[model samples]
Target: MGPVSSRKQSIVFIGGGPGGYESALVAAQLGADVTVVDRDGLGGAAVLTDCVPSKALIATSDFMSRFKAAGRLGVGFEGTGDDQHAEAHLSAVNRRILTLAKAQSRDIQAQVESVGGRVIQGTGRISGPREVEVTPDDGEARTLKADMVLVSVGCTPRVLPSAMPDGERILTWQQIYDLQELPEHLIVVGSGVTGAELAHAYLGLGCEVTLVSSRDRVLPGEDADAATVIENVFRRRGMKVLNRSRASGARRDGDGVVVSLEDGREVHGSHVLLAVGGIPQTSGLGLEEAGVEVNDGGYIQVDRVSRTAAPGIYAAGDCTGILPLASVAAMQGRTAVAHFLGDHVAPLNLRGVCANIFTDPEIATVGYSQADIESGKADGRIVTLPLSTNPRAKMRNINDGFVKLFARPGSNTVIGGVVVAPQASEMIYPIGVAVQNRLTAEQLASTFSVYPSMSGSIGEAARRLHSLES
Candidate 1:
């Protein structure tokens, strides 16, 4: 669609996430007219506010969790040496969070620029069918022509107006870093992954924490047994978990915030973190006017290849209501470009994608789960091996989590696996590869694992399934 007059079949990407920038880079390399317009930095929410920063903070919090068990490992600490040493440790962690956030943002920007893509920092909206109107930095408005428009605007933290984030006492997930000092009595209102994660992070950092959940358990969306383990761990750490509770409002006290529940329960803390959920950043983007199909929940509706109902308009990442992860977003973007350029495009297979909640006793899952199979949602067999019996887990005094594997009944080919323990995110990679390649449990069991290692539990799980099949 290269034009004779003024156009070059422009490909305009309307966000800067893994999805947005990756596609922009690919299309640019393929000689398409590429421009990415975003309101904030090039990396969007994941790099700037959510994933990178949250993971950075989690790094220190993970250390705190390990420190609590150091005594069991014959490691002694003499009360941090002094008060000055304690303060130094806290400040070091805080500074590292900010440093990593900025560095990750810069790296994403550099990736886009290196690929010959134009990055315009502004709020972009669909002005017409093939044009995106952007308000430039200095308040100048410009319309960017597009032969194909890709919306990858990602998501925003959902906030209830009744309990809005003041960014001081009360804060959204994005506002967590603004605290000058550690939160004493950090009350997190929401018991999903985000809520559970922050509550655990603060609790590990020695903050008295309470978790509020409107459901019967934390991580209501996860496997029931996995959620139970996390809840027990939270309680063991002295976290006050208020299940079946809803937050009515929040108010700033003299030095803290008081959260009122619908059942007349009051939880007080130095800070309030609203871990409710996320909503797509779709409003005011001129989506409806351009006839792009949007789901009832306001997410852009697209096929597996990321093509929307509207002609020449595609969406990816969180905006498409697909699996919300930096990795998923990047793949979606690349696939959309492949389809647009008339190249062979494999439809997105979300089954093998791994999603990990970076919390103490981290939860990681790829593909199917035992619960999903038993409930008839999927067809598979489940074999679980407790870590208590694993040699490495016994050596580490770790008796909490287990490796649960799911595979087809007769063939015994691995379909999915879940790991619920420290560093489970990193350990779940082998299961991801096994599922992707349709490897049998017997083959996984045959692979050797280093003796006296946590990863040996993975091979043990596979061996258990092999025994069941025999």
Candidate 2:
């Protein structure tokens, strides 16, 4: 190591997304001079168009869906007979979603500036290993001297040449918020997390939804049991799911869209929402010139500490192709800053990371999965308890979903867990904690969870794992 510089370190972030803004906060707090240059507004696509807006729309859909259960709970709409229906005003909902997203973006910018970090609205590109050139919308270009540069430009919705978005009928998830009316018949192409989530949201919003999945089932990357439950629920709710259908292209019809399948079949719909996937925003960033290595898929290659191949250059978030969750990006950002500052930091343990899909009967998982055990990738014991058996679930009329736990075979230490329930995202936290701390199944079972709560099922599942071990 060379002699330590007496001056404070200067850090430049090339994006304003979760990774950049989050790490800027940490770097500023550590007494480093920080600057964040971004072309999009502060919170980036994840906040402005993707994650926040979609979730806000989903919240409205979920709330509207609850009205269906009111009659079972002895609630009445007085004079509406037994047919009470809730309507989602698309214009109003879209407005609210945009407002919330913009507000959050402003808040994130404020938080960064409050911590002594400078936020610049500009397009950033690496001019050198330690230099970032920024071009603002209306100002002259400027170069920033950075002791450390973090590239986290995030990703964009992938578009296929065969099917193009017109922003009116054919659309990407980011463009849907601009719609003034709900789609009469929405055909969603793709069945991954984003596709499943938006398809269900539209279905809940009373649109005739047709989910097109190329795989044998939806959510192929998630827990199999959870995907089955969601698929069943989608079908039960009148949404049409076409499995093993590969969309070749989509074209405009008279007043609707026609999606052509590879099998010489066509599905007609009022609109088509393409949720195929996202491409990392790594191009045009001069990564090659900076000596930062980008994989063939355009993802920045980084270690667990978020270090790129080039010295003093780090990458995080979707650009890094790590877990695409916002939480994971935030953690990566913090970890990068900590490591750069020579502060105590733990290398990111992906196995302990928790991921959640935002949908009705949401699926959440932490640590190893059942597939890992079955595939002989891990040694564990498993137990599953259905939500139908939980008193709270019964009282709430939630008939579907379950809690599954995994523990070490001999030691009984909690290794992982999967939750398929309404708000499973919230329920997975404790299991995440257990897995992170290597807590035993007995310890998790011994903890006091409120009786008649959905969380109680987690404890029950843990208790049952002990029996499996014996």
The top-ranked prediction according to lDDT is: 2
As a whole number from 0 to 100, the lDDT of residue 191 in candidate 2 is 99
Clashing pairs in 2: none
In model 2, the runs with Cα more than 4 Å from the true position are: 1-6, 80-84
RMSD of 1: 2.9
TM-score of every prediction relative to native: 0.94, 0.98
Task: Point out where model 1 deviates above 4 Å.
Answer: 1-9, 78-92
lDDT minimum window of 10 residues, candidate 1 = 81-90
Going through the candidates in the order shown, the clash numbers are: 0, 0
Q: What lDDT tens digits, residue by residue, belong to model 1 across residues 22-112?
A: 8898887776788888778877888888888887787777776776687798976675554422221556676778777778777877888
CA lDDT, every prediction? Answer: 0.85, 0.92
